[model samples]
Target chain A: MSAADLSRCSLNSATVKHASLTELVDAAAAAGLGAVGLWRHQVQEAGAEQAARAVAGAGLRVSSLCRGGFLTAADEAGIAAALEDNRRAIVEAATVGTRELIFVVGGLPAVSAPGQGPRPDAGPGDRDLVAARARVADRIADLVPFAAEHGVRIVLEALHPMFAADRAVISTLGQALDLAEPFPAETVGVVVDTYHVWWDPQLREQIARAGREGRLASYQICDWILPLAAEPLNSRGHVGDGYVDFAAISAWVSGAGYTGDVETEIFNEEIWADEPVATARTVGERYARYVRPYL
Target chain B: MSAADLSRCSLNSATVKHASLTELVDAAAAAGLGAVGLWRHQVQEAGAEQAARAVAGAGLRVSSLCRGGFLTAADEAGIAAALEDNRRAIVEAATVGTRELIFVVGGLPAVSAPGQGPRPDAGPGDRDLVAARARVADRIADLVPFAAEHGVRIVLEALHPMFAADRAVISTLGQALDLAEPFPAETVGVVVDTYHVWWDPQLREQIARAGREGRLASYQICDWILPLAAEPLNSRGHVGDGYVDFAAISAWVSGAGYTGDVETEIFNEEIWADEPVATARTVGERYARYVRPYL
Candidate 1:
């Protein structure tokens, strides 16, 4: 087994969120990396068309567009608004020259005021998770044509079940595939993020099934930390910093015929504080050590 | 659709951790509840024989034993020690006259030192969750015969996936049933705890399967609260106080022919601060209002 080549390494912008779109692009090229994953917020900050021109101008490939799905809204008006925003996201992904538009299908819609973040002390309401999930499926179906016409794919990312309440209702790759089964694989596929699916008992079988069905849209990597951050949303660790078995998981991912860019996507506050260039270098080195060998 | 009969209500001692075994038994009987679930710690505190006598004398049935399985140790010594501890728990349950010995099967063995709890800053070690799960299956097989001989059933409890690292590896009812399938239903069964299994996408199907197999050993209820406490283990709320839809879930339990005791097993700091008698009365009222009608 030789060392994993840097050709497949792509730095997700969220990994070094402090970096501007230009800084992320220049950093990846400066670090001798092959590609970069862009987030919509950062892209929107630079104007989507301008961000796409900058990446293309630098000769860097956009591995994926950060997000486009929050289809589970509390009301009919909210659902219509989400669909309108997602349509714009499809056009943005196409402009950025990335077919993969990752969808973090949202959880149960909040009943609170629009600007107020999730109230920690709020009691549970009549949020039907199953119904929220059904809305996601229907909304995705509604968007598939627009996404396909724009030469983009709807990439469904199943977050860890802990986030099932406020982040994403799709808690497993199997569930994601089940939702995607009725649609064309190229139009609606699933994201296999190790950070989310590593704890799953049926991971290997489901990853294999995802591959067999041609629904493996993306492969994101990050480690799972313990005594999770005060807000677990930022608990993702740098590669090799937490408890995920990268070697084993990567072997399964590679075995499933996935030859796409392996994006390092950490969301830790501690990692976000480090210098972007230094973090990218460290992430590359760790990926080579922990994940590359198996690949 | 009249009010649910209180004849089947059981107060799990942990729900009122501040209460002594005698107090719990007396409170449940005084509340006109038909049964009480005992934890080994409480039973050991009162002496199993004494606890048994107190419950019997109070005319209350021992609904089920709190737990007995932490079988996923990393070393032979740890495995042997866990087996010995579980063996004692079995005898304790039998001595207290309960046929169901509930098992909260332990998670990946810790590499940390004795008395040192899970380190928030610890790096990922070589803990293989799959292998640890295999060890749990093997250990449970080793304990099944002893459990059968003693006229007690090994009840597998699938905890929420958040506890997969330091607590329990069985993260879903489906996974628990898979582990229990190799053994006889009479000797091995699965617990249906709303707090643990409520997030599951396959809840209805799995609960039905457990019923069809005659393996629904215990049906415990508690609400899932949000802004989970710093230590998530104590985040359980009283019924109707959190997100779980008790009417929907309890109907499934009842349709499956689960005529056993409905144990209210809450573990919240707020709930624990209340007087035991008052807590019991509140729980009974909530159970009747939220879950009993469905059952």
Candidate 2:
């Protein structure tokens, strides 16, 4: 596949984080990329309108405006604030012609909302498992209508089980689907990131299930670092740098009926220090090389 | 819940790793522990017969062996050797009169079997999730007869997802139970470690499910370190030092009809630096204070 066939591959600004918001858009456009995912901080740094204009002027699409999923342990007041902030983000995404708001659900109450007082800690057994699930679903239910009014689809990203404690209460695709079952698939769906879900046993089937239900809101790719026991965090590898078979995963998602953009979301510290253009060019080429077969 | 209730608490030798096999057994007995879990290396160093004599002399029961799970993956022949070695473990466990053999199902064939050539890497999509699960069941099936002949139960330890790559493919209680579903719940069950399962949203339900089905083999306790994102690996805290709710977990297990031993299993580098007696004493006190409430 040429760069044009790979136009659907979006750059999640995180992949070239060294670049400022303006430079990131310029780099994406210069590279002939069609879509880009923005971080809220980046959007704020450049002024949302200015950033959106930069992408629009470059003829690049705003695939998704990341983040708005920390509803796990926020207080009523905090929740209200977060909802309002998310609404603003949605308006910004809309200004840039982005339709999806990606959610990286917060972990623990403290981590999710740093200033919040610690919630009561439960023992593994004391975890009112039923209540926790209900809490998550209820919070999402409350936020769904607000998100819908903004015409911005909310995509819950399923993190690894390791993050289950303080991060997202929803850890698996199945769990996310269960949460989304009550709402329309289009309004509330999941963003499938390879790095998080690759280790799951039910990946293929879950992707197919999501595809069948049209619940796959976003498709992001990142490789899993080997020797997982080595570096627990800040150890993400670029595509084909580690053990995951991109071709197989891409094939599965494609087969599952997901025709959405394949967003490259890399969270490695190593790549963050590189020159923006070099990072984007290299990663884009590699994804085109290693990940293109499946796409 | 004083020392009297400590009757159901077992000291996995690894918890007091500072001690030799004989010393660990001596320490447990000194603390009035009801049971003890031994490692193959510790047993080998002290001589299996002598180790068995020590436990008997201490009037302490052997809860389960530390491990015999890594089906060596260097080669087919090596894999066969591992099975044979597991048989030896069965004999050893029987000699010591322990009923359950804890299995830490090994990871990547090569890393799992250190001396083996490079093992094939996992795929992009839940790398070999299907194969790993099947292999675990098949390997256990192959060893079941030997275990049955010796009246030894096989407890597949459900590890955290981080270790899913090379430590144990059976990462969750649900996965472990699925592997145990075809086998007798008595013969095949799970070793639920607090550190591993505490983060799982489905933990309580799974524990209850395991108990209802008679699949709860052994219960282990430890604490999870805070600010986990800072240092993902090598940051496990002691029982009350971190965020896990041990008392609540203990209550859930006991409530689930699981009357088995609650083994203290800490894997902290800091504690390991101390002498075995001190570590064992600390574990004993914490087990009594924090865990007793749940019991």
Worst ten in a row by lDDT for model 2 chain A: A110-119
Error of 2 at A63 (Å): 1.9
TM-score of chain B of 1: 0.94
Give the top-scoring candidate (lDDT). 1
Q: What stretches of model 2 exceed 4 Å from their correct place?
A: A110-133, A227-232, B72-74, B110-127, B228-233
Encode model 1's per-residue lDDT on B220-241: one tens digit a residue: 9997766677777887888876
List, residue by residue over A127-154, the lDDT tens digit for candidate 2.
Answer: 3344455656777787788777777788
Docking class of 1: acceptable
Q: Provide the overall lDDT of each model, using Cα atoms, as 2-decimal numbers.
A: 0.84, 0.75
Pairs with backbone N, CA or C atoms under 3 Å apart (clashes), candidate 1: none
